[model samples]
Target: MATSESGSDQTSSALSDSFRTPYYCEENVYFLCKKLSASGTAAADGSDLFVVFISNEKKQTPLWNQKASKRADGVVLWDYHAICVQRKKEGDTPLLVWDLDSSLPYPSPLTSYVSETFQPSFQLFSEYQRFYRIVHAPIFLRYFASDRRHMKDSAGNWTAEPPKYEPIVAEDGAVHNLNEYNEIHAADVMTNAGDFLNAVFTQRLGAVINENQLEEFFLKMP
Candidate 1:
């Protein structure tokens, strides 16, 4: 577990170290939590980081009500949104939830966000019922970084050729070939300013109504 001084600016350092994403919340938060867990476990005392993945299935959640592009099926999918939860074993710092979807505060306190999102007379975890899913961090890390599919080589090149995949045998005696999962995971390390700009902004993303031509167009935004 990481230590922190309450009300200090130090806690925000973790947020700064979190890698940028192409507005892909699922991949972004997964990678961020993995990085934080690895870094936070190196304490002098033998304490490990605790991170949680919160999934919302209720239609009333903020994600389900977002104004952005949603699925055409008129149903807010569970995998559509995800947030990283971290509880520090330090001071009185509240549990932090990282939802980088632009609509919610980047690093929001868990309770505060829950209060805002849940029903008016909600109890912490009791009222959630079947609408919430919680998975321990370590177990999730197993499935997350199991392969180097989206990663690069030592010389800064694509790790492997396309159609790169792993083989798996299904329960029904069927063999399935799974492609390199992260082949298109938002361009691992942003190539250039243009790449960064294009990855983040869509036509109507934040206040900019038009698609940007280049990085300069984004920099000049009010």
Candidate 2:
């Protein structure tokens, strides 16, 4: 499969109209996002008893270059996006993830030869536009762990470096997605997590969020 740079779906639509119907997105591509997001509610179903779409965008076509995006077969494909979904709720967090299935394997663009030479790398919460939107509230962005370095002064045992991803009462405390992830342990820590996130948001994001919407978003999170 030939992958594009930006991976937008605009090119794909043009292909369908110019060509025939019943075309397919490259491997691991989908268009389910329009089911709920087109209206803007972004309502998702968590009770289906499978991988949850923690993060995702409509499936898109890869961009071949700056001005134009075409397919490896020269079909001019379009419509592409990343998605982060998982079976475990704890896995949802500030980190970036793959679309649909966590193991969907990115960089795996539709190629003309259909050979797996280059693979894409992406996570759910961190990186690109996902990071920007996750920090904003009115939506639940579950963060597992992001940091690993912790200090255990006079105390004993392995303590979670950053805390706040947990479900206990919180005040300026939450989790954040880590772009540089080596192990899952870093984002799994709690306690100081929520408070830490509050600080980051206030200091960096300013006041683009409404506390009520943020709280309500989390409240509905499972």
Return model 2's CA RMSD, one decimal: 18.8
Candidate 2 Cα errors over 4 Å, as ranges? 1-82, 87-132, 135-222
lDDT of 1 by residue, 1-222 (tens): 122334434544455344544334445555566565555522322122222233322322323322243644222323334455555555454465555543344455555555443323533342222122233344333333323333456776754432223422333443321122212121133435454444333211111111112223323322
Off by over 4 Å in 1: 1-18, 38-61, 64-79, 102-105, 119-130, 145-222
Cα lDDT for residue 150, model 1?
33
Candidate lDDT (C-alpha), each: 0.37, 0.25
How far residue 74's Cα lies from its native spot in candidate 1, in Å, is 18
TM-score of each: 0.42, 0.19
